[model samples]
Target: MRGMTNTLTIGERVAWYRRRRGMSQDVLAGLVGRTVDWLSKVENDRIELDRLSVIKNLADALDVALGDLIAEPSLMEWVADSGTKTIPRLSAALMDYRLITPVSSPSPIAEMPSLVSLAQEVDELWQAYQASRFGYVTTLLPETLSRCQTAVEAYDSDDQVQARRLLAFTYQLAATQMTKIGEVELAWIAADRGLAAARITGDPVAIGSLLRSVAHALLAAGRFREAMQLIQDTASYLDPHLSDPSPELLAVHGTLFLTGSMAAARANDTDTTRTFLKAADESAQRIGQDANHVWTAFGPTNVAIHRVATAGELGNVQVAMDLGPRIDTSALPMERRVRHALEVARAYSSWNRTDDALSTLLAAERIGPEQVRYHFLSRQLVLTWIKRQKGRPSSTLADLAHRLKVLD
Candidate 1:
């Protein structure tokens, strides 16, 4: 098994680790409360292990880090130096409390990022994120967050409120990016910070928008029940304003419903899922057009996209296959489009349409390579395809896997 870590599939790695630990298949299987036959099929890669909870159980049984079995290549290996340094700096920025109290002498006001420039840059970063330019956003996030903190302290009255709003929005973006890359704990921290800032602004729209981030991080961390509760509570809190809602408020409310739908779907609560989806659709109809108000991308088209996604999450692949292809996603942002494409690919994979699945994945990569590269769905689908391949994978499949760093 020497040097196999870089090339072995997750199942193979599990086998290697089990053997190295002097454990039998029966012993390992019993430890994880799985049958030996199930363990055998898992080791042979006959079944793909995609669920994080199941993988965590296996890792615990094997006495390995979850990353050891997942083997996701470092972001730096694919993007560059920024990956190694970005997270720590972002953490420091998140932890810095100088804005709350003078921890040390603050940077000179002249040295701080100007409010006007910071607002513009915040919008630009959100645009970059929606366009799936994640690596670039990660590189800039630490400094931008620090600047928002500084702006809150430097300004006063209305300017301070505006600064706090920007700070909340920036933290929302950070939480979103962290969730995308599997940094769930950090994502939660960012979401908490965003919500705290939003509360200080006393803006319902700002608070509502941060609720989306908080719910998103919760979903990523598999806390579906808590996520749904938060969404429901936020929706109730914003209900009074919806009678004569601004576009921003409508978008934020609609986005909260969409997140709720996802949480319900993942929790396998069909009734709640339908209810949330219906609410999202009603909000979309009221909005009248596809728009990115409050950066929620809430509209009829986005609601449709989420319907397909929720179906996929609930194992209604037939519905996803039926709805996913007919919808024109060209009008949506690259993030939503790529995400829908990945769901379509998942539908195809589950339907055993390997060729269609691979083609869809390839097309999604062409449009958003970074998004596909870091996404768990794409990685698992590609790994399953590799396992299902007999003699050897075609050059295209091999190339994609190599580029995704699933193979050394």
Candidate 2:
């Protein structure tokens, strides 16, 4: 009777085990001789799991014992507060990696869209990312990536050069989205591919932008020293162009410096952090206060936001708090605004201001519920706050935890 009452639905257990093994539905479907769409339906409870043989096959494909699928851990908590679509969609997008290959010969120009059209499509993808419409981005990325890759390989003349630039930026957008969802290895691969495309284009500015994307993935993967070395190596080439840099070049350069500053802060190199932050400040001042570049939001206000983040990472809670209110985040995108609020929440947590931390986190949630609900840091903060409460938590906190799925 206990087992009957406690058993996880086949869909829930299947999804949990699949994610635990880091296998996408595409991969699992191939292993089990099924279509991804079919597997998705099963995982979403659209179909019954009544066939014992099929269940066994799924267990084998997932490399888990069949019994494991019948019963999940009773104590397993922290189910995602948001819809289950995000990670699965990301995984599906990454499956397109196998389709990308080097183009050996150019296709006829008449068969492909113009270079300007391809570039505009890539820019539209970037806009989707900036607006934090990740679901729509997921829908766009596979076709965009395929189209860009084809354009790059198909053009034979000066148009080919521009096509390569567009392709490189498309890959950078993929890397950015991958990194946002904590898929660092996939992000690294995308960034490296973008760098290769940029190098082929022979554009220093594009190469610099791809390098910053690579550095971001490295930092996310906890390779701080490697990330710092990358920034150092690439900065030398790009720094010379600063004298009369285009706004594009300045945005990339400023973003690189800001990334380097954050990496240094994470590595506990305070002096290096300060040096990079100051350099970034100079670049931001030159560029002024706007998200002028389509690919990056690295202007004065954005730089100020990173300074607060850097201070927080360095364990300077009071200092971060002091600087937080001075920076106006209105010019930034929704993603940046939510991140700044989360950083301030982190500082509040560090200072043992539990109520302040909760308030800040709630504000961030209101600003971007999808981001807060899916972010690992937000989950950890809510869990920690709940554990630290004395006796019964306030009704608001209790309701918040339940909504966040930090408590069942």
Candidate 3:
């Protein structure tokens, strides 16, 4: 096992570890709450092992750290090649400010840009973020944050209000990017700052937006109950405007419901998930399809995509796959489309259609390489696929694994 660790798939590693511990497949399976046949498939690399919870359970049953099972040199190489430094830098920035201190002291009053220019810049940054141009966002965030701080300090009261609003939205963008890169703590800080600034601006919509961002961070951190409560409370507070909903109101409202549904799904609360999803669907119906209001992209098509995602999350693979055919990827933005495809790939993997899953993932990569390459789950899928091959993997799969840094 030690000699072949570099070449062995995850299933082989699991079997090796179990055998080294002198445990039969039946014994290990019982400890992990799985049947022997399931264990055999996993050991033979006939099935993909992608779920973190399942991995953790296996690690515990095998008396190993979770990282001991997952850490691989190839994956490290991929991370290095990915150039994903934004999350760490953002985390450092958040730690520097403690989510309380301003980003920086003001420049001289004369050096500050006018509120109009600042607002325009903010719009550009917002557009970049919504377009999923994360590298561009990383390039712009430091200067934009500094400028926003300077404006917040330099402006008079009336103008300062708008300046703070710009600052808040800028921080919200930071939060969104940080979350995408798996920097949950940094994302939380940025979202909190956005909420603070939004409150100062007295804009209910901005507040709602920041709340949604914070809830996202919470969800990523696995605080599903807290996330659900936060979103539900905020949604109720903002419900008054639903009767005469502006696009912004509808977007936020729909997004909040969507977030609530996700949190509930994570908690295995089917009733709550159904209720929130129903409300979101109704909101989407009213808004029609493909609306990118506030970059939430809350509309009928987006709702359909989430339905598939929610079903997948709840372990209803068939339901997720059944709903997948109804989704119109053409109506989604590039980022959303990539995500939908990846979710379908996950469903295929769950259904033991490894070839279909790999094809789906590769297709998504072709459509948006950055989106696919930088995603954490993509590496897992690639590694699992590599392990499942009985002999020499096809050149196509091997080449992708090498490109993705999951194979030597």
Q: Using TM-score as the measure, which candidate wins? A: 1
Q: lDDT for every model? A: 0.84, 0.73, 0.76
Estimate, for each residue in 1-408, the C-alpha lDDT of model 2 and write its tens digit: 112322244555688889988998899989989999998987865554433345656877777654455432122122233233444554565555444545544434456767788888888778767666655665567667777767876777888888888888888888887777656667887798889999998887899999999998987666677888888888898977778998888888888999998888877788988999888888888887676584787888888888898887777778888998567787788788888887878777767787998898888878676566545456556655665566878887887777665566
- How do the residues 191-231 of candidate 3 rate in per-residue lDDT, one tens digit apiece? 99888999998877788999999998887666678988998
Estimate the Cα RMSD of every predicted model relative to the unseen true structure.
3.5, 12.8, 4.7
Cα lDDT tens digits, model 1, 97-198, are 764565678766667567899999999999999988888888899888888888987889999999999999999999999888867777888999999999
Ranking by TM-score: 1, 3, 2
Ranking by lDDT: 1, 3, 2
| Model 3 RMSD in angstroms | 4.7
Worst 10 residues of 2 by lDDT: 72-81
Measured against the true structure, the TM-scores of the candidates, in listed sequence, are 0.87, 0.75, 0.82
Model 3 segments more than 4 A misplaced: 1-89, 98-110
Per-residue lDDT, model 1, residue 140, is: 91
Q: What is the lDDT of residue 143 in candidate 3?
A: 71
